[model samples]
Each structure stands twice: as C-alpha cells, then as structure tokens.
Target: MVKEPAVTLHLTRIGPSWMDPITNFLENGKLPDDEKEDKALRREAAKYAIIQGQLFKKGLSHPLLKCLHPDQTDYVLREVHEGCCGHHIGGRALVITRFSISEVVVSDNGTQFTNKKFTEFLTGLGIKQKFSSVEHPQTNGQVEAANKVVLLGLKKRLAKKKGAWADELASVL
Candidate 1:
C-alpha cells in the first residue's frame, strides 16, 4: 500500500467569535450599547464569509480547482461573495461527484440557492437542479447537516457572533 501524506493543519489567521454582545442582543432582546462597536464586530464576522470564498476562488491551487466542476470554477467567488448583506452568508458548494453531475438547487432564498450566476453556471453545464422546500430544512438533509457543522465552526471561531446559518449543503448522490 502506498503511504498517504500526513494531513496538514491550517490556522485561519482569522479569528472566530460566536457568542458576542450582538448575538445576545439579537437573541435576548438587548440592544447593542455602542453602535460603532456593534457594526465593527459585525463587519469582522462578515470578513470570514468573504475570506472563505476568496480562499476557494483566488487562493486555490490548480489541483484543488480541478476537484470542482468546470462550471464552478468561478462559483466560489461568485456565489459566496455576490450577494447583499443579510443575504451574503450562504453555504459552500459540495462537488458530490466527478464528470459533470447535476448542480445543487436549494429552495431557500439565500446566496447559495438564489444567485443568478450560480444558477446560470449549473444550467450552462446541462445539469438539472432541484430544491428543498423553503423554511423547512429537512427537505435538504445534506444542507441541514452541513449548516450545523459550519455554524458550529463559525461559532467557535467568532467566539462573539456571526450573522446567520445559510446553506451548508452536501449530497451522497
């Protein structure tokens, strides 16, 4: 058997703070004391969402990009970064297979599922798309689970607060 290379660990060089005053404020109905600090904290959280997209798009090595569908070459940069705030923090893409499979379709109206660029790319590739029922997450089991994982990770990273739990999808098929 060939020996596999050891898995390397990566530090974000970015911070993660999940439970912050804004979170408490949003959840428990306590408004932010200083709007400046609140905005700054929120702005910080937004960076990770953007950074992850950047890492996938601009930062990926050719080999890594090869792992994604030809259609998704610019998908990371386009889908993740090309939405308005309150809607930008969508999920990452799941390749699920090789050689031009169907693209992902989510029912929920957020960055991942609702972007024009994403849909156009998938359709351009001649792949079919499907959606889980909106508001009810169970329709998309893969996404729901992925969301949990990303959210948990984001929470750990932020340690203060992140914005939302958008699409975090995957599929065994």
Candidate 2:
C-alpha cells in the first residue's frame, strides 16, 4: 500500500444503445427525422437510459489512458466514466425503481471512485461506494451484460448497412 500508482486506469466504451430512441420518444413527446436528430446528443442520451455499471467495476475507462505515471496514486479506482456513466445509478434506478436506492454498493479505487467531487456528490446524495477485491470482474455483471447488449445491437444493426459503425449507431441504437 506504500507505493501509489501514478494513474489508475478505468476503460469503458459507449457506442450506442438500441433502446435510446424509445426513451427519447417517451421523454420528448415528439419524434424527429434522422437528419434532424443529434448524433452526439443521442449517444449521450443512450448513457442515461442504459447507464448500468459493471457489477463491481468502476464505470469510466477513458481516464485510464491518460496515465501521467504508472505509480502515484495510493490506490486504483478502475471505472468507466466518473460522474454519469461510472456510477450506474440511472440504469439501476430504472429497473429497480426504489430497490437499488437501498442496496449496498462496493467498489475499488478507480478514477471514478477516487474523484473528490464525485465522492462528495455520492456523500451528499447518500450513495455508497465500497471497494471490493482487485480483478474480480464478476462483481460487475450488470455492466458486462449491458456492454454486450450494446455491442450486439451495434453489430446487428450495422451488419447489413453501408456506413461507419459510429455513424450508423444513432439510427440502430
């Protein structure tokens, strides 16, 4: 515990969620054509509808790549996205409604976990962040499943189309 990592890596990729449009439809109360839709906006929107975290894994992974040094931090908080995606509260809340609000959440020190502002948000909101054992991915089962579904949806939709995966994701997802 004496040696601190310079940067703790938490990697996650958010492509597209097929259920995005559905949620938009429900939220917006109106529909727009493809040309009128916002790709960047929708991609971010997907995060909200399907914002599930890996069972025991941190949510954000982008910060992992920006390793200023290999050894600096006292610990590693491996997560995907710290503020929104890493937490996975939206997705859990969607399914469980009031159940997950009362469940215990354990986590290791990923970037999302170590963030001061994020921690303060969790504390103010009364959300729990617990650190589990290292490398035990099974804890993040919901995230794994969610990632798989997104990947599968992307493949199934774009497989028959003629365009870039990212480009086609809005329509498919």
Which of the numbered candidates is closest to the native, going by highest lDDT?
A: 2
Q: For residues 30-147, what per-residue lDDT tens digits would candidate 1 score against the true structure?
A: 5456988767766543332222222222233333221233333354445446633335433443332324553554444456555665565557667666666666766567676765
* lDDT tens readout by residue for model 2, 53-127: 211111364222222222322224343345324665576567756444523445545564467764654575587
User: lDDT of each structure?
Assistant: 0.46, 0.48
TM-score of each: 0.24, 0.23
Model 2, position 136: C-alpha lDDT score: 74
How far does residue 141 in candidate 2 sit from its true spot (Å)? Answer: 7.4
Error of 1 at 58 (Å): 47
The CA-based lDDT of model 1 is what?
A: 0.46
What shift in Å separates residue 171 of candidate 1 from its native position after superposition?
Answer: 22
